[model samples]
Target: MSDLEKKVKQFIDRHKLIQKGSSVLVGVSGGPDSLALLYFLNKHKEMYDITLTVAHVDHMLRGKQSFEELLYVKNICKDWDIPFEGVQVNVNEISKESSSSIEVIAREVRYDFFQSVMKKRNISTLALGHHGDDQIETILMRLTRGSELKAAAGIQVKRPFATGTIIRPFLCVTKSEIEDYIKMNNLIPVYDHTNEEDIYTRNRYRNHILPFLKSENKNVHIHFQQFSEQMLEDEFFLMDLAKKTYNKVVSKEKNGDLTLNLIEFRKAPFPLQRRCIQLILNYLYNGELPKDLTSIHIDSIFELIDKTKPSGQIDLPQNLKVYRSYDLCVFTFHVQTKKPYFLNWDKGKTLELPNGRQLFMKEGSVPDDIGQNIFILDENTEFPLYVRTRKNGDRIRIKGVGTKKIKSLFIDLKIPHNERDVWPIVTDQEDNILWVPGLRKSIYEASDFTTGEKVILQYK
Candidate 1:
């Protein structure tokens, strides 16, 4: 067996990439790497007890040339007696319509075609020809672009796709090894001229960075592959830990809001803290992170938590809000401005406030003690009291503090920004602010409990 073949076989075995009697669908682009992988898999099909089917995509970028490349792959499949599937996607048109780059659209359509073929053939394994050099370039590119932790680990050798698994067996071999194999087999492979151009980021990395790294160390690809594998393994273990810690420290509400316990989260290790934040974001975004959500947002969350102030908030992509109030951090998509509400309090009836609190006014003798939530009014006081949300320029008279604006009271009490809008405020018939429920009572509250009949206003 050739050294490249031996290396790939060992990699597949070590990773448990394929099972015996598996139906494998190979993605071929008529390139040297993919052509070599197809030849190697076809040569050892009987030994591995696997069936082979070829899937090709014509990302109609080069017009006729791209279609011809697809035909070449189909012809090769026919010569090898392997089943063939091909697709044509106008990647340029799709890119324009989707506002995505040509390379991203092409990759999306190619993978979509590959998965369709796998599902049609009931294939359990889908193999791609991503060599070791590709792994190095992917890691470097992601790091340069400030990708998140898991993304910086680079392309996984094996991951779940559709109803089966996608495997990259050639990740153990370098690009030069694939070229050598193609030459030894006298194979003719079509080249994409775009790959040689420096317009694309990956091509620039391939043209310059790769040669420099390889010159310093001939086996640099091997070291990079090992680094990728190690990173993936560590990420897997840490993510598991983070998930468990998340369950302990994060609470998901019925309305899809997330409440994180900063105390318990801060107790966790630093790595797990970052991962827990990632878990929260993943849950909030339904596992589909927005493209613009980079590590900077995650750092912002950390900064919010570490700040000495007890309360702050930061807006994230997609209208999400991260609020830190005291030891509690909340992640929510609901940032609707609370509508100002004003409701008249009918005698002997309960009024429900917008913040889910109940307020009632009843005629009775004053209790011996008045709490912050209860306000006693004399019979001669203002009639037709009202309960409403705070309005601009709202103020109340305190016993010792004199007049204080409602906004200043909320700030002094360290109320969360979102809650300050909906906090219930009590007013008399003349629009005079009387009491801030669960907070302060205005000086208008009847201090002489012994006088005549009394009106008791209590908040629940």
Candidate 2:
């Protein structure tokens, strides 16, 4: 067996990247990296005791070239007697809608389509041909773009993906090694013109920094491997620390929201505390940690806790707001811009929430139309509704009960600490909260939609 084949097989055995008799979905772009991956893995399929199929997604941006590439991939799979699946999508429209870069959109589309194939065909692993050199490019780019420790961390050799698992056996190899393997095997790989265009940031690094560094260090490829190894090790340590610290201060509610105990977090080391915060935020916001977040923002947040200015607030980019609440610090991500979690509470009728949800108001009884359920409010109660994040002074009146502090109510209702503030609260003009949207409406403003003429409520 070839050295590349042996190394890949060893990684697979060590990590259990693939299972015997398991269906593997290959994410092939027909590039040198992917081509080499497919060839080597296919050659050793019998030894690995795995069934393999190739999946290709054509963004159709390159027009005929993309189609040809897809066709080439299909033919290659045919030659190997492996199943081939191809999908074509207009990522242009998707990019605009998702507000994602073309590369990001392509990645999502590819994974989504591949996941569909996986479900349809019962495939377990989505294998990609991302080599060690690609990991270096990512690290360099992230470091240049001002990244945090978590952001600068290198890729994992194997990850538990949403569908099943994603493995990159080629990560142990380099781009040059893959190209060499392709040439040795007389492989025909598709060329992505975009990689050379330097239009995107990665191309910029590949063109400018990588070559220059390569000249400076004859064995720059080896240097990339070393860097990835070190970064990978550092990443594991931080993540492990984050995991341990997260368990110390974090708990999840029945509703699936996570609670982070600031009181407990206050005791841990700064790095573990920060890592825990990043982990929670990353899961909530989903995908790549905030790039623009600076040491200044981090310090400012600490100041909120440090200087006893718990009531202070700071707004970071991407509609993320950080506030300190005396006992705890809260970070809220306003997921939607235009909506802004608006709820206009009127005297009589129903007040609709932003999420196509209705908060019905009637004089006496609860409505039968309870998909999301409705809230009752009375005219003698609070007026001119205000919706905002949970504040230190926040309080709520439990139905059939007296009153409770927001923090106590959080413990009572099992509201997660991390989510307590970010949870939208509807308050009257006097700052008296009328309802904790989707949870409860204030007893003071309990309504039956009888007093007001129309259902006057603002929804996002």
Candidate 3:
């Protein structure tokens, strides 16, 4: 057996990615990596007791070159007596419609097409040609971009796909090894010109970063791949513990909100806490992590949990909010456009805000121990109190200071851009801003508080 075949077999046996008598669908892009996978799998099909089928996706970004590559894959499959399936998609249009990058949309389309072919062919596994070098690139990318232990685990060897499994048999091999195998077999593999361009992040890593790293350490690829393997094992163990902790401490509400028991959640280690947060988010999001939830978000959650305050809230990606109310920490998915909210609050009544928070008004004295949730204003200031979201040109005057724009205050507080629009702004009947929730109180009329009548605003 050839070295490529031996490595492929060893990888399959080690990962148990393929079963005997299983039908496999190979993604063939006509590039060296994929072509090599197709060739090797076909050569060893009988030995593995498998049948081979090839799937190709034409991204339509390269004009005629796209069709040429599709023909190349089709003819090669014909030559090898393997079934060929190809689909055409306008990746540019899809990218624009989905607001995603061309590379991301193209990969999505490719995988969707591959799964459709797999279903039609009754294939139990779809094999891709991601090798050790690709794994190194993925790890370095996530590392430079700030990743957690699970993200550092890099590309998995085998993951569940549409109806079967997606396997990467060449992850144990390198690009040079695959090239050597192709040369030994006198194979002609097409090259993708786009890959040679360093515009893309992966290409930059492949063309520039990997070379520089190799100069310092000759075995950098192997070392990084080994590191990924080690990290993956650690990730799995932590995830298992997190899953158990999630079942114990997490409760789903009738309205799809997830509440984590703070008593139990705070007792867990920091690592499990992070994973538990991620696991709950994935569960609430239908088994997928929100793309915007980062390590920073997770760390911020830990910080919030450690705080001595009775109630606090933090904004997360995808309009999700993690808030501590009394003894429970809740994760709420609020995906709605911010609309101007105007409500009138009578003394001793509760006013609802646009974000589902309530502000209770009561006739009381200004207590010396008033906390952040309490706002004291003159009761005779206005008859009907008003509450609304921020609007353009909204300015508030500080005590003994000039008027400042609410936007500037938000910038000073380091409020994220997405949360600023929906942040509640409390105003009087005359439209004088009184308080900004979770932020500063107006203090605009501090001198006017000499009156005996005062109304206390408490947030709930």
Candidate 4:
């Protein structure tokens, strides 16, 4: 076997990228790297006991040139007697119709096509041609763009995709090695001119940063691949720990709010704490993190937990609210500002509030024991009672203690800021605040032995 073949064979065996009798689909772009990968896989197909199929995407960015590359790959597959699958997509037009760039749209289209083909053919593996140099570029680019450590780990060699797994057998070899292989095999691979331009970030790293690094260390790509593998391993272990820690310290409410126990969260190491926050954000965002979410937002959460103040809040992108009350911190996508509403209550009727709560009013004998969620009013207390949200400068008269601001009451009760606006406030026709449901009641609460009929208000 040739040196290149031996190296790739060892790498694949080490990673267990392909199983015996596996059906492998190769993504061929008619470039040196991909073409080399295709040739290598086909040459060793029988030895590995695997079936090979070639898949190509004509991005239609360069008009006829792109289509010709697709044709070249298809013809090569025909000559080798390998099954071929190809698609033509107007990526430029798609980009124009959406907010995504051409590069982003092209990658999405290519991957979607590859996944569809894999699913249809029941393929067990999709092999790609990303090389060691590509790994180095991806790492540097992500780090330069302020990516977190997990993201900086860069492209993975093997990961789960559509119906099976996507494997990168070329990651063990450098771009120069792939070029050398192509030349030795007498293969004619079409090149994309755009790859030579510096306008793209990856090209910039490849054209300028890569040569400098290679000059410093002839085998830098190997060290980078080692670094990437190590980082991924470490990240995987830490993230597993973080997920366990999260399950222990966080509880999900029925309303889709996440309540984390700060006391328990702080018991973990700093690394786990950071990852727990990331896990929370990922869960809350349903795995698609907002672009604006960064380390700064995470740091603010840590600050909120560490602060001496018992209650505080910070707003995040996409209407996410993170707040702390006592030892509990909540992450929710609920709206912070509730609309102010004034709802009138009729006797023996339930009024549905905008905040998904019900307020019921009735005339009956006052109970000796009244809970925070229940209020009793004097029989002569005025008609047309109202249940509305708190207004500015709203205060309730507390027996013997005089009047207190609703805002102060909320603060004293440690109510979350987002909930205070929607808290039900019971009042009389004269606009006299009677009670704050599930909280405090006013001085007008009647006694059980009162001579007249009493009004009972219950909030649920």
Candidate 5:
């Protein structure tokens, strides 16, 4: 009946955030924003027939304070009679394993936990506590990182994330509104000290960039928010156009590489070309694709495509390669051909490559003692593994054939020269060849299947 309730109702209705009797799993951190969210959503339980859950992630970065925060959140959920659950993760280990920052790792681990809970409970909606402040901070951060107009578009009210839909009912609401609600309702939420420190990137935006922008314009947040919404509209149109253009110009080869028609892409406008490149990147490389590969990167790709020789290769950041071969711009995973990235391959484990990447290996059988890495190695296998880029002197033997320089082999194999650098090679401690990971193994090792060798390598 109050104005806040009306506003919440309007937001959910405008976004169609949930259906009547729909269940939402809320990401709560015992912070003011999430606490206020729980209060309002719970208050309207009857009208919407909504089922609510409070899920918290204890990052364990703040020592005892982190545990206390979790307990506080648990108690709050108890007071409201809401279902409460949480998970604790060693974010450092995850960051190291995934080659991601702690911020990214925490998000991944938290979302993984949240989705598992949602799936088990048959929940359809995942509610985040992000407000206008978070939105402005995000935009500023993206901008600082060289995001263009379309990339600077405001975050959506609701978008598909993880297994289900993630809805932000507070996009229209400012941080002050959430705080006022908490203050008026006597809400007690834990304050995270990290938010005050500029150690994290987001904190830098929150602590400095936003305040400076506010000081200069006084209405910078609102202006950017509006700008974002408008940009979103434009982006939506561009993406649709890109999709149409992509369908006309893009095809897939039998080898799973994307083939973009150079003539068609060159014919389209620059924006369309950029969008098409983005689309190709998104579709070909699955799982959390960077929505914003720089214009420079895109333009570089364009230049490569425009002058691309048959089977020509271009390398972009994040290990993305654009192959201009066979009259198609084949977007490929930027795999090092010469030296491969190292995965700690022990006696018993599957080393998962970056998502959706298939490590191409030469046809082979394994001896029983030879490890998965060295499919056909004898007892005299190399150690202290060296995974590096290709050197000039590298050589490999062809089965029943004599040895040949690896360089000549690649050239003969029609491997795009730029792509040759991205293929990973594995070596032993003595710097001897063990495997050309995802490709051919060096001839120093025997390919004849011997005892204790198991050769079952697969990509999923």
Candidate 6:
């Protein structure tokens, strides 16, 4: 076999990225790196029992030139008898709507298109052309941005993606090797103008930082790649330990709140403690760690835990709040809205809450089956049904008990104070609490059983 094929096969075997008879989808952009990847994989498909397909995404920014690139990739796939699929997206429109830069939007749209193709084709593996050079650039970028050790691990060789796995077979190979392979095969590859422009951060790193480092050490890319691999090993160990620590001390509430047992948290090692905090933020943000959660933010959390005061709090990114009240440290997103969410109860349709939650109200007898979020309103209710957060002077008539303030009820339930501000409440026109989801039902004894028409309120 050829040198390029040998190197690629070794990398794939080392990473165990592709199993026998794996159906692979290649993300090709008609560039040198992608074309080189397509060539190598196509030549070795029979040996590996691999089925190959290519996906191309046009950002629609370069107009005719963009279409030309897609056509170029299509022609190449045709010569190899591989399936080729392409899509065009209005990146400018997406950027405006998302309030993000064109570069960020383009990356998101590109990956989205790749995932769609994987799903449509039932491919089990998605291969990309990221090389050692890209890894070095990423590490340098993370270093300058004050990222943590995990961020410094750079691009992974394989990661879960779109019902399968994303493998970077060329991660161990350098850009120089790719160019050499293309030259040896007498093939031409298209160049993207955007790579030459220094406006983007990656381009700046490629054009300036990498060259400077290469001057200091001729094999700087190899050195950086080795360093990143070591970091990845250490990161994996720390992450595993952190996950175990999290399971032990962290308690997750149904209402998107996380509580850390402060007594137990303080006993763990410092590394686990820091990772625990990171995990909490990631959980609150739906597995995406907040970008602004820096070392400073983490240190502040430790400081809050050390404070002598029984109750202390610190604000975090994305409207998140971390506070310690006696034995529990709560991590929650307290959305402080100048205008509270007030909506008239619509029994026919679902009411969309601020944070992707939904409120459903229906007029019927209580359903035999119910979830934690479901509540029942008395059929003889005399007041109008409205949904909003707690307001001062709000009172609820607890079932089998006398009237109590909402504030007192929250305290009695040990609900994190930070979450109480945004905790949704369903109230009647007289401002009487009908139901506090996952907590209690109304005590207003109304004889609704005669008609048996109940207003069922559910938050999901």
Question: Per-residue lDDT for 1-460 in model 4, tens only?
Answer: 7777788999999989889999999999999988899999999888889999989999999989899999999999999999999999999889888987898899999999999999899997999999999999999999999876778998888998976999999898888888888889999999889899988888999999999999999799889999999999999999999999999999998779999998899999999998898899889999888889887888898899999988898989998988888888989887655788888777787887776678888777777777898887776777678888988899999988899999999888878776788888888888988888888888887755466666688888
List the candidates' TM-scores in order: 0.82, 0.67, 0.71, 0.86, 0.67, 0.73
Q: How are the candidates ranked when ordered by lDDT, highest leading? A: 4, 1, 6, 3, 2, 5
Better of 3 and 6 by lDDT: 6
Superposing all C-alpha atoms, what RMSD in Å does each candidate have to the true structure?
A: 5.3, 10.0, 11.0, 3.8, 12.6, 8.2
| lDDT accuracy of residue 449 in candidate 2 | 58
lDDT of 3 by residue, 74-181 (tens): 999889999899999999887777867788889889988997888787888999999988998999898888766777679888888997899999998888889999
lDDT of each: 0.88, 0.72, 0.81, 0.88, 0.72, 0.82
Clash count for each candidate, listed in order shown: 0, 14, 0, 0, 29, 0
Deviation of model 5 at 225, angstroms: 2.9
For candidate 2, lDDT tens digit of each residue in 28-70?
Answer: 9999998888888788888878889899998989878888989
Clashes of 1: 0
Clashing pairs in 3: none
Worst 10 residues of 4 by lDDT: 446-455
Cα lDDT for residue 79, model 2? 90
**Candidate 6 residue-wise lDDT, 253-272, digit = tens:** 76777888988888889988
Judge candidate 3 at residue 202 and give its lDDT.
89
Tell me the tens digit of each residue's lDDT in model 5 across 138-200.
887777787655656757777787667998887766777788898989999888787889888
lDDT of 3: 0.81
Which whole-number lDDT from 0 to 100 does residue 315 have in model 6? 89
Q: Worst lDDT window (10 residues) for model 5?
A: 354-363
* lDDT: worst 10-residue window of model 2: 451-460
Candidate 3 TM-score, C-alpha based: 0.71
